[model samples]
Target: MPNPWDLPDELPTDLPVSRCELPDGRVLSAVQEAEAHTLWEEISSAAPYRKAAEGLRPGEAVIDVGAHIGLASLLFGGLAPESRVLAFEPAPKAYTCLEDNLARLLPGATAFRQALGAASGTSELTYRPYVASASTLYDDAEDDARNLEAHLDNIGADERTREVVRRTFNVSQRVTVEVTTLASVMAEHDVDRVGLLKIDVERGELDVLDGIDPACWPRIRRVLLEVHDIDGRLGRVVSRLSGLGFHATVSQWGVYVGGSVHLVLAERD
Candidate 1:
């Protein structure tokens, strides 16, 4: 396992990074203004992951898969100061922002510029610079656009706001990135127990779960992920967790009622 600290010296100079100041006075770096604001609203203000973060003890570990720009990571760090935060992000620009944010805000945290999947290898990731949070290895532009439109309508976003979001998904680029399994990461870092495993990899939630070797399942105390109920994925994920001795609960925010997105929280039985 490579040390995340030894990041490449030459970051893309042309990448446009925007800095957002939260109401609480903390600043965050992001590529897109709208995406950053939305993330802050959900991860910080709304605090959807709050329930799963409860009981996080000192010195425990929180693994954030698809950590777009470290907003959630910052939340976890603030919730449990001594706890270690291991954030995994595959997008190049996003990873750079994530690294910088963690360095300034959560010095003890570690940011990995790699994706966790069912295997260890390299793969092409569809990265939307304008909507960085939606980037994923499993790209579904049409479905994503539909879901976004529905969500905006459900929340009663104005026409201008809807147009802004529509433009964000219009352009994207594919970048090849390193991919590894969660079991491999745990073994390399010697993580004996995970306080929480928070995953929001667009539609790649199940693949992330599959990356965990059977032996590592019991080590994860809690699992929180955004599940796109494509096909029978939601049910399959619930069954898989149940089989691993976890009690899984599924719920959807009112804004996502008509969309395929749902949140699943699984705790060990």
Candidate 2:
């Protein structure tokens, strides 16, 4: 299947592909990068159906952590439209682009421009907007860019760029949106059943999962995650989930930051 993400040239040879709504289905395609928007399609979370399918079924509660320019949400919406999707994004500039993309593709989707961490209070997702390729919130942008070092340097990555600290990726766009554990979110929303829960929170995955309770673990049937470039976070996640009684695995898929993300599955018990 074609990647649902609209790539740099996904717009085709047609010059300046602005917004166009098809007559029959009303698929409004908008081109953001063409107008020098400076955003890149994160292969990490954009497409890859298996990543989205892992531990996923109908009417599931799928949480998208660090959902930048939401292609995963679009996939979940398509796969499980009836499911409740909490798409979290934390970059102001990128979140703006995310809104534009979601409005055009997933109007029914709920957008949370905040970061989801283990402790849940707050943490910085150190980044270099100049290195848009490595903007996955909590992960080290430098390391994630190692693979794209050459290509990105030609386009972006400037040593002279200014640096700043932020609690949310979108500090200016902060909304103090309710922060809750995956368990808390489900209970509040009256989620009797959770089909799939996906997290791509950079290095924050370790902390996020660690924050959950043993009871909450079993409630989730499947878990797809983009593990950080840490020593044992990936293994810890699989072990923890498996211990809670669900089959899990690290899947093979191209990602912008970090290596291939892990696709851990935990079947309902």
- Candidate that would win on TM-score: 1
Highest-scoring model, lDDT? 1
Report lDDT (CA) for all predictions.
0.86, 0.54
Off by over 4 Å in 1: 1-15, 158-160
Predicted structure 2: lDDT: 0.54
By summed lDDT, the worst window of 10 consecutive residues in model 1 runs over 3-12
lDDT of 2 by residue, 1-269 (tens): 64233233222222232443333343333333331223223432444444556545566677776666565676677667677776777755546655776777776667776766555565444443432224554445454445444333444545432111111122221223334466556666676666666776656677667667677765766666766545676687777777777776555433333443454544444
Pull out the clashing pairs in model 2: 55-222, 90-169, 90-170, 92-170, 118-207, 118-208, 125-137, 246-266, 247-265
lDDT of 1 by residue, 13-76 (tens): 3458989887788888888767788778876654458878888877678999999999899988
Worst 10 residues of 2 by lDDT: 161-170
